[model samples]
Target: MTEPRWLDTEEMAAWNAFVEASNLVARRVEQQLREQAGLSHPQYEILVRLAAEPDGEMRMTELAQRVVTSKSGLTYQVTQLEKAGLVRRRNCDTDDRGVIAGLTDAGREKLREAAPGHVELVRANLIDVLSRDQLRVIAAGLGAVTRALRERP
Candidate 1:
């Protein structure tokens, strides 16, 4: 086989740190949302997406795509949210087979209540940890990485 390509020492350290930090950040954010808002990350994302849509709603498949979740996963999450009175499901008038997910008043209230503490957790756990220059570099780098990943086959 041809010589294997591997990360150099510094690159390897950065990669490991990025992975660990991402996991820790996600866990902490999820905990905060679940405790304060009765919402998981996926649920919160769905609600947020619906609330931000033109009619405060989106087609279920579109929502799944926006949230980067599978159809079954989004359906499960939406069902749970529906149980909590945070969202409602409706059949699309334009297409009988298409479903629409809408944010309820309770969902908006939950998002409003959750946003403050969620932002605080983000600041405390990640944003506040970086210096101004570091923050800029991180933002740009992360955007590039996200774009690359999304573009990948």
Candidate 2:
């Protein structure tokens, strides 16, 4: 068996820094969303995806995919949002077996209100910290990684 190579000093430093920064960014964004909008990060993501859809509606399964959440998890979150008058669930008109989640007018208003804070948080924690050149480098590097990973066999 061949032994796996380990990261050298410089590589280790880069990897550690990237991991720490990624975690911090996520935490900061989550905190900002909760503090400014009374919404969790995952909940905000769900609302954002729903808002982007035509008629602000999508099937439960589609919502799960868009938000990268499990079906059950999405259902639970949707239920909570519904209770808040932010979203509602209904049977799909064309398919009896399918359920659809729809964003409410209140949801749109909440998103509109929350967007400024979210944008500022992102800019303050991540975007503003990067130069244009650094942004281009990061975008190209991460885009390549995602493209490679998303390619099918």
Candidate 3:
């Protein structure tokens, strides 16, 4: 059998950078959201995704996809939001077995309150440190990675 191809120096550096930067950014975002908005990063993402819809609503499955979360994880987060009175869920109008999540006025207000600090923290930690060209390159590269992964099971 042939030996596995290992990462070379530059590839190894790139991999390390990706892993470290992603973790740092995620942690900072989580911290900022919690401090300023009493929300977790995943919870903030759920609110943002639902807020983007015209009706401030989306199917729970679609939301799980959009947030890159598992079905059970999404359900748990939604339950927390529901308890907080920021979100509501009901049977999907078109599919009895499906669920839909809707953002309440409280959710929108929470998002509005949280967004500024979130954006500032993101920019400070990642975006502002990177040049525009760097941002474009990283976006393209990560977009490809996500697309490839999503295409698989």
Q: Which candidate is the best by TM-score?
A: 3
How do the residues 1-153 of candidate 2 rate in per-residue lDDT, one tens digit apiece? 998899999989989988999999989999988888999888899899999988999999988977878999998899889999999999999999999999999999999999899999899888999999999998998889777865844
In order of appearance, the predictions have TM-scores of 0.91, 0.87, 0.97
Clashing pairs in 3: none
Least accurate 10 contiguous residues by lDDT in model 3? 27-36
Q: Candidate 1: which stretches are off by over 4 Å?
A: 1-3
Between candidates 1 and 3, the one scoring higher on lDDT is 3
Error of 2 at 45 (Å): 0.8
How much lDDT does each candidate structure score? 0.92, 0.91, 0.95
Cα lDDT of model 3 overall? Answer: 0.95
Root-mean-square deviation per candidate:
1.6, 2.0, 0.8
Cα error of candidate 3 at position 66, Å: 0.7
lDDT of 3 by residue, 13-120 (tens): 999999999999999898889998999999999999999999999999999999999999999999999999999999987898999999999999999999999999
Return the TM-score for candidate 2, rounded to 2 decimals: 0.87
